[model samples]
Target: MTQFSKNIVSVSLWITVVILFGSLCNGGKILVVPVEGSHWVNMDILIKALHGQGHSIDVIRTYNSWFVKENSTYYKSITIPNTKGMDEEFVDDMLFKMINYERGKSQLSAVQLYSYVFKAIHKTHEMICQLITNIFESAEILKTLKEKQYDLMLTDPSWGAGILLAHELKLPMVYNVRWTATGEGHFDVAPSPMSYIPITGSGNTDKMNFFQRVKNAFFYLLMDIQNSRFNLPLYQTFCDKYFHPPVSFYELLQGADIWLMRVDFVFEFPRPTMPNIIYIGGFQCKPAKALPHDLEDFMQGSGEHGVIIMSLGSFISALPDDFTEEIATAFARLPQKVIWRYTGKRPSTLGNNTLLVDWMPQTDLLGHPKTKVFVAHGGTNGVQEALYHGIPVVGIPFFFDQYDNLLRLQERGGAKILSISTLNKNTLHAAIQEVINEPSYRLSMQRLSHLHRDKPVKPLDNALFWIEFVMRHKGAAHLRTESYKLPWYSYYSVDVAVTLFAVVLIFTLSIFLTVRYMCVKCCSRKRKTE
Candidate 1:
């Protein structure tokens, strides 16, 4: 080769290296609007992955967000000012009240459910509005965000302000929800057939009777009405006041690049889905690590009877005294050792067989060889972990999707649902015994665990690939469906049905008139002849 050609090649290679290095060093700038509550912890895996991959993340959250332990150079967190009613104490108190309300009503009627939901919804709206208002009011913060030019806005749709922020900044959004997306009123993201897919926490399944379908339909209708009447108006008002060209609030949801829902068909029933929806269930969960020495010793102490881990998630871990007493009594009867997560006052009736801790390493415990079953409230994350480890369960569901989650597990023969309102020592013990005695429960969970693990790609990688894909393609609009483009009547084919009926009616009338005319003409001719 000539000297000139060799020199040219070397120069080109160096230039290419410089460009590629720069691109790798400066990845996409992402803006996240995460929940300030316990739910914030759920985003830890995804956010941490993005950071580790060198993506710059700027999170706008409430003050003292539990999401951050220490400040990170890779990530920037800006706390919204004037935020109130977002403290752990407040959260605990509200949850306690909700538990009491459910206990008062053994089973919630539609009216009672609506009443509780309405109050909760109303309160949530106020807090969201206030936080949003704070963000807009913070001139320095708003200016900084605009100047940085974020590539994407990843948010939880439960917070309406996040959607508004995405719109105002002209950034594409991707929803990251902890639960099954449909239960959280993310109907536009995916199609959930009322005939089969039951509402979460409804204690109904995909296989419903005719009356059950009607009831489920009514429940969904009521929720929609509530959203439109209360939630939508508030969101619209915020947008109209803050945004430049105010668009329909719901339209933005349709325009999302993707929806990362924590749902898997292995545990859930198969249903209709859209192209933009991605089920990254159990992404947050990892292979459980070694238990603490103390925990290991405790599990080993159970011997042949095995240990049952009881942690009702963060929301309801601080259960009432009476409930704890009954649970304690039930545990005392069992040969198995119990580890319960409790945060409030120690129950006087707590038995020697039970070990109470402020926080329990639930996933690690579930994975332990000595751990036989999980007694939980059926939170999505907890249920996924239990199912992942192939553990049978005693589900004492309290509220929200807890009931529905347990009911599904029960149907699969891997769990038993015990109502919080009607729970007693005898009932709890029997429920636990039934699951422990049945070998089918363990077998079912093992099958499900295998199915869950036998996936083509790791869930985190799947999530990251789509996220980076959106950044590269500028929202990947091609993946979105045309369904969102249609109006309500057209989407449901109501207009098509009505138009067809009109055409058929007109055709029938025309035929009838022609027949009558012919008959009349024939009769007149016959009379003249006579």
Candidate 2:
């Protein structure tokens, strides 16, 4: 044969092998139900990554979704109509009320604050339940969803609507979870002791004193009450109305095939975890991309002083005008250039060194070497990115687990928390200065970055592998725990303890009676001889 013919044959053979391999790795379809705001941000990243792996993706979004776009190259969106779901207005109002309470501008007492928070959360969950009800009531949507035959249901369990849908569809479920319908995700699936695992809003660290433990337990019970009183009833009603035999929404949540937890031990304090729980903390983080020319020039201008970047994540467009002025004034005093993400009116105290923009490439800026300190609202995404880039933080927590997130970093000596009520020009300035001047803050954060990076596989890749593992194996039932199936008393071994106590009590009483009888007979015989 001619040399040209031989070359053609080899090339064709290689092409055929490649084609066959690609066919073998063809991706499965995924149905994603995601929460709005920052939760959507995290889920979007995972969806894009999954799409890159040749997976076909379908997203279930509300008609008025705040972030999830109706059209996307990566996924087909199923928009549910006639539902007043969570939107920008809802979030803004909640943040405003929270800020008012925190800054003592409102007449709300501490008890009122809890009441307001629970009420707000209850309203949000009520809206979600209504949305789910709309979906279930619509025969067309349910028919379409059922016809899709997705390999798995991936959802954020912060709302129980997704959990309910997954159950209705009878698909193996996976959670992209940090928060569940009740408090933290781990509390739903794992053995979370109140001694160390601090509840959200509790502000306690892993190491707690006696009073701190009491506070932690109180917070846990409070959250339990909140879940039972406000959240569970809405979902339970749905279960009762829809299913032949009503299913517990909490049980379905706990029985998920896998949990792609948004935190690793590097971010979280040491705690017991299950085999099906995979840590993918910092998965949304990536190496710094080249900044836009304007941003790059601004960063270079700082020289040795470096830059301080501030963002309150996606939800808050701007703080109250007075708060912004205080923050802007603090930024003005810093020798370091400031890039503040603010959409409110320009602060009167703003200095020449500060630049205010409506939006920012948060992860990219954090990854930059010139970025020394992150001034954030202590959202999980921002905190994890700061850790990934080895940047210290000066956390200005507003509400909803933000304080606790910063508390973890502060306990590890990487960040400082400033309450919104106490935040002012001087306090904010001092915190930024303290974090910048202290080498330990940067050093501690860098150490965490190293540990977070030292994992065998990248967090994103690990998440993808496990996701595909579930798809390939149909479900990860082998890795899931059956403990979730047990009733609360049985799981806690309260019944066994009660049984053992009863047996011991009966044995002791019998021995006492027998000894008393012998003593009585001996006494009678002695008396007769006398």
Candidate 3:
């Protein structure tokens, strides 16, 4: 072949090879440690999905600890130390103070009064500086986490403190918010009017009852009060530190490059949302074949009827003869077998059909065909799993975002709730029966489950792609805003502009008056001389 022809052929081959290589590198490496409950579980699954797609992953978590069940292979598990416990009260104080400060109101309460005392100890310290310090200091768990290198961060609000590490390292960050990002804390504080930036919703199509909606409103009010009083000042200071003299709420949230939502579009009906956010519904999990041997046997032993799975959550237990008795009494009349994730010793008498274990693979057990209903504490993790399997639930929400999630689920016509304070056999049985006999409820859950599982890409894949995207883009600068960089006044600049306008007006008026005085004096002098 001619040398020119050979060269063209080689160049063509090189171009084709590069295109092929680019197509092959579809998935990206990621490092994530959402060590906090269902949030972490979903995060871990996402990391694994990346690994499945032939991308490298490193996860940080606690190792085999009973409290967190912390261990991972696809990614290194970074266990953050809880030595200082946490400043929940301090956080709340900070939040409350920021709320009232924004309205330009006085009369300090709660920790504001305490902050005055605390401020005495650190007269040299600035609250905004302290808040930024908290973000960096939140990596208190990093002593254990530094063992691994991460390119990007995937965290939840509960794990928001973890974002401090990413901030300190100047890593690109994307947060997964499970509840309303902002709101009043009347019914529940986590999910509120402020949940979404544009302030619509996840578009779950599920609207709460009038009372539930009212409760949501109440949550936002409390949030407004607390955030306006506490977080706002720290936020404003953060803004001033970065943007220099001006900040807005919109700018504050826009600081993060991306925000993943724990909402299912199938559930949200019609709510506006911003471009940076994506809702990954039921990313918690999907059915995976049969249950483990013992669990499957236990389910079959339930006789003619299917079984009921009751779990308060990983944190709380079913121990104490008291709570056990409530379960026993509730199951007494049921013909179905009951398998409870028992934390305490066996009650003196568990019903003949009942089986109790310290813990069972919840998703595994729920996937069983014989599994009919879920008696859950209404945590986001458990809720997502149950919805994934199309299992109707009798919610007994304990705390956190559990109550709000349950309310939304019940409103959607799939789940029913019994108050934890008023829990008993009658209430339990009623909820169980409703979930079991209601075909429509089953249908609602199944339909939603399909949509949740029907994503263009698995949540894990999506997460991995973003993580790699951040690494490739060197931390998405386009996604970040200088809201936190500017001062409150400078952020708006309206005040600054108005003040400048007034100053110029006054200066011009003074110059005109002086010139007029000189002219009149000169004219009078000339007239007298003449």
Candidate 4:
């Protein structure tokens, strides 16, 4: 009991010291949540930095992992609701379903693949999941306002209910946008890559790859269905009660006071940006740590051949057989050892040089001295991990803004992008070779790593400071944009512009008909009188 007390006291003192430092810095009640998968890891970092600064943190958990430090207070809004066991169950079920689905397939179909995904999210029966997340998350944010009384709420742009609740409670909110390609359509914001930026017009005009375009269409279609079933219902209720109608889709992010992109200029494409969109790249890092045991063994055992680390990220880590087979075929030709993080049955054709595991210590592996190349699906957290360790990449971007990330990496000469559709042994082998053999790739990557790590006060410091500043100042209103206040039709000018065009066309046609009618009538009267 005494030991526990001492530990608590030690933590309290540490918090006091950080708080003292932070008070000299800024003030606010801080609430953080991440509904998007492993992006929660970034939230963990924000929580630590804020807690260290001695600010009260209301960490609302919506996923499996929560690593709040000792003596820190937290609230769980809606959990992915799956305990670790539940997560395992989800994976196991998904893997089995995907495997069987692929069993009879000759080639992979996008519709079938995504259908399986929809089945998985629904199977989780996320009704209670969403409600719990919304209620708890809202409760935590409201509680913080009521207790420490927040000046602002720091949350992801689309983190479950954080966005909605912030608007509901009328709190100042800072939006942490993790990727860059979250472009104009996303609340008419400027370009910021998830982990990188890209060249762009007023908004990003770069066309997506086939897979990405298809995925975008698919998501949009799904959201359209959801908008009707769920969003419309909720929107109507709020409008009826509060007299403030919710803006349509793509107008959501504009509601926040600020949107902070967790990305870097060095690694991203150049693009026009708004003052409201702040770039806080590589915000999800801690001081470099030593490599883990399994990673060290994998690195040292590979010798000069080095290792190719492949991960589809947390979302697609469970390799469907068709995707898995495609990867297996690619690695078979490579002379280098491939350490693949695949949660699937190993293909019989897989070579001795390739190692398949259910999971990987990705950060530890990246940090190892012998690690050569990283093949990723190009998510923000994974990009940060790769850049942090100076590992050049082979980006097999599957969906969303991953294609943008691939573009940035390629522009820097630090990586290559292989279309997942076109990826096979010959293409992947060449990409791996080009990334590894090229000294420029290594040099470029190291330079980026240095730039990413050189920020003053660190991202954690910035996030913590902002949190406290919000509490003290009641949400730093000067930072927010009033874009969200505009209605969707007005914002897009779709109704006004379209209506005007239609009216003009009709007016011109009506004048032409009137003139013709007058001519005919005058001629008929002259003939009758004659």
Best by TM-score: 2
200: Cα error in model 4, Å: 12
Compare candidates 2 and 3 on TM-score and give the better one: 2
lDDT per residue, candidate 3, 1-530, as tens digits?
A: 99999999999999998776754475444555353444555665666666665566555443333333445566554443432222224433433343334323438664565466345323212332343344336655444344445556665533323344455454677766654223311112112242332222221223455555655555445555644565545445554554434545334344666666666655543454554555666666766667777777787887668988888775564334555687787887788888888666676557777877787888887788888999997877788888888888888765445666776677777788886546677878887987898798888888767777877798655655665676678677675444446665886697889999999999999999999999999999999999
Residue 352 lDDT, candidate 1, scale 0-100: 84
Q: What is the TM-score of each candidate against the true structure?
A: 0.91, 0.97, 0.66, 0.67
* Cα lDDT tens digits for candidate 2, 1-530: 99999999999999998876674477788999999999999999999999888889999888888898999999999999988778777788878888998888988788887787788899999998998999999999999999999998999999988899989998888899999988899988899998888888888888899999999988888888888887888888889899878788778888899999999999999998999999999999998899999999999999999999999999888678998888988899999999999887899999999989988888899999899999999999999999999999999888888898999899999999998889999999999999999999999999999999998999999999999899888889999888989988999999999999999999999999999999999999999999
Model 3 spans > 4 angstroms off? 1-35, 50-72, 77-82, 85-150, 179-217, 230-253, 318-320, 477-530
**Candidate 1's residue-wise lDDT over 1-530, tens digit each?**
89999999999999999876765676899998876544666776688898776788988776655445436666788767567635665556656666666678336564675586677757867787888888788888789889999999988776677787888788988878743212353466667788988865455788999999988888888767777787778877877787766677777756778888777888777788777888888887788899889989988899999988988786654667787788889998999999988787787877888999998777888898888889888888899889899999889776667777777788887888887667889999998888888899999998889999999998888898888888877797888887777898998899999999999999999999999999999999999999
lDDT of 4 by residue, 1-530 (tens): 79999999999999998867856465345656444455566766665566555555565553454333223344334333333212445655655454454444335465776666655544443432354344544655456445655556677654334555566556777766653112323324643342222222111223455555555555445655643464334433443453356443234445566666777676654566665566667777554467667666766788887898988777664556656776788788877788888876778678887888887778877877778999998887888788888889889875546766766777777878887557767788788889899889988889888887877767656655555555666655576555456666876688999999999999999999999999999999999999
lDDT scores of the candidates, listed in order: 0.79, 0.91, 0.60, 0.63
| Candidate 1 lDDT for residue 79 | 69
Better of 1 and 4 by lDDT: 1
Clashes of each: 0, 0, 67, 26
Q: List RMSD in Å for every model shown.
A: 4.2, 1.7, 10.9, 8.5
- Ordered by TM-score, highest first, the candidates read 2, 1, 4, 3
- Looking at model 1, residue 416 earns an lDDT score of 84
| Worst lDDT 10-window in candidate 3 | 183-192
Model 4 misplacement above 4 A: 1-28, 61-151, 179-187, 191-253, 322-335, 346-359, 450-457, 487-530
